[model samples]
Target: MKNSLKLLLSSALLLTLAACQGQDVATLNLEGGDNIVGGSKVSSWSDLSKHVLSILTGPGERIQICTAVLIRDNIALTAAHCVYQKNKIRIAYGVDLYEQGNEIPVDKVVIHELYGGPGSGRNDLALIRIAGNLPRKYKPVALPSVADTPYQGQELITVGYGRTGWMKGAENDGRLRQVAVNVDSTDMNKIWIGRSNGKGICQGDSGGPTFLKKNGEYYPIGIASYILMMSDDPAKKCLEGGVLMNVVSYLPWIHQNLPSLN
Candidate 1:
């Protein structure tokens, strides 16, 4: 069963990547190990911790395949690639997979106009508006100042419900997890993270939140974009590093679409 699931996921990723060929941006299908590489499972949920959510695509099977972050009572921030498809997108809030927490139907989705398709990873952002307000436990994460810049070697925290291992067929436990990743480098619109330590983002983590701690408060700085493969292993895990779409770079677009949240 696990092997079948992995194969299906790989095929889906390949199809998405193939569709993006010829674009200036780099592209790679989604593949990951058991969970967030080198990260630990979160045993409990924090007050704002529920801000991180699992995104389920498709209609019948409804797989909890991607992660997203709540930025307002009704608005969520996620990778454009995650919602590029025509399938129904649902948001699950909570730490456990079996708990059947609040599941909200997405009322509308707004992908960045310039998003260069799924694998391009350029302008990779989207805003999802739920049909109604979120519960009290779920709170929006604060956005970073557009002027802020990530520096190399700076410590950052990532939270998501993604796969756990680098080996093939490693399963996602469906539990929310957190990991500390150091910023390896940065560009005008992206932040690269990870190193030999193995701690980094993985498949099913796309659209999750990358946070910057300031004055002891966590602020959303980037959205999980894609993995930067450094190996030719068939497993296709994030052995090299990962890329994050700098949230600051899209502040104007975000504010323009969700002006009420700003």
Candidate 2:
């Protein structure tokens, strides 16, 4: 079953544990380079910690995933694939995934009508509605109505509950790390090149927010969709780099379908 799951989504898992493992903070080379990520870079993990969340099935279930910020207080955003398999999806606030903490039940799920597979090249966004008011500690991140396009040397930050380590034994440890990678280009939804060669969004980091740091403010620009591990083919729909759908490009569809996501 696990093998089948990976084949379907191309998600990499650390063998010793179910947690994800692809990239880390130390790997990011934030200095200016060939691929510009954003206009600025993230200041600290403290500023973006609230945006990180654990998407789980129960207090201690194996079927857990990671997600990221969308709105200020009411809505939680993630990949359509995360909520599709199970309806009883819950968002756990704070860094740890094991504790019940301030976990909140998701009352409703709104997926894009045109959403296909994770590789379908369509809208892959989903908005999860909590049953009641959100906890004070779990503040939301703001989604930009519009975003500035990426340049050659601009830096960007990606935060999520992905694998803390790049090896098998440390999967699912549930520590959120931020990596600063320069965006190579935004040709389509497929190929996203980064200056930091070893940094990227892994399996568990799916649906996490990719921030465009500008003038000390982080804007939700894209949702982490897929990561490219071994290619440089520009003609392919997916490449050997990370793939993130532009949230700013789909703003109209997102707001019209899931107002809470706005």
Candidate 3:
């Protein structure tokens, strides 16, 4: 994640706002929640990293503002906030410098029209179509057929290249890390905790995937969205922890809008 983005410690104290400031992801207080949870890490493009893509704003932006996951053969899933007007956006996949397969570009991008919210729902998600078929080297992750599972206190894996440090200007890349977090039951819209182990998504991790560990496989669960309400007093400027969005809530929308890629 970039240094400019803001992550909230708790969702309860979030100040109701329309748009997120430069780096502030003002949603609701997310700290000490019992519903959301996470873990896991990936440094580069592997079987795991292949599912992870850098959602770059432009060809020469020099930095990834967020991360995303490939849900279908050529469809990449992410947060709608990552999409901006006239921005040169694309997904970088199969990024193995030493191997034959490397980066794959996105063919197009589509975000929900009501992502910013119509002032009622906290809708925030997007889909990206790559320019070509997904090579065998890169396969997409499976989405949950039902949202009946992944209850609060459940375990999950949070993977991304977000900044490792808490202060501004701190950054992480290539290398991925995983941390265990608990779920915030009340806030069905978020994934809670993760900071106790000194790890959580920030800045560049905006669109990264939060996977649920079940049986012996990982299922896509949440997409890192906005963070509202700081851990400490904002007037005192204290940074405590942060929160992430739950993508599972949009399962019905995802099924209805996703274009069949076969």
Each candidate: how many clashes? 8, 13, 41
**What TM-scores do the predictions have?**
0.84, 0.72, 0.71
Assess candidate 3 and give its lDDT: 0.52
Best first by lDDT, ranked? 1, 2, 3
Q: Write the per-residue lDDT of candidate 1 for residues 1-262, one digit (tens) a residue.
A: 4444444445543443344334343335342211377777766556436678777676543343678888887788988877876356777767765444456778788898998876677898889887776667787777888656788998988888766654646555567888899998888889988746878887668888888888877788878888776445635556677889988878889889996433
Per TM-score, what order, best first? 1, 2, 3
Model 3: ten consecutive residues of lowest lDDT: 9-18
Badly placed stretches (over 4 Å) of model 2 are 1-45, 58-60, 99-101, 119-121, 188-191, 231-240, 260-262
Better of 2 and 3 by lDDT: 2
lDDT of 1 at 181: 92
Task: Estimate every model's Cα lDDT from 0 to 1.
Answer: 0.71, 0.55, 0.52
- Predictions: Cα RMSD each: 4.5, 8.7, 7.7
Q: Candidate 2 lDDT (Cα, whole model)? A: 0.55
Tell me the lDDT of model 1 at 213: 80
lDDT of 1 at 106: 81
Best-fitting candidate, measured by TM-score? 1
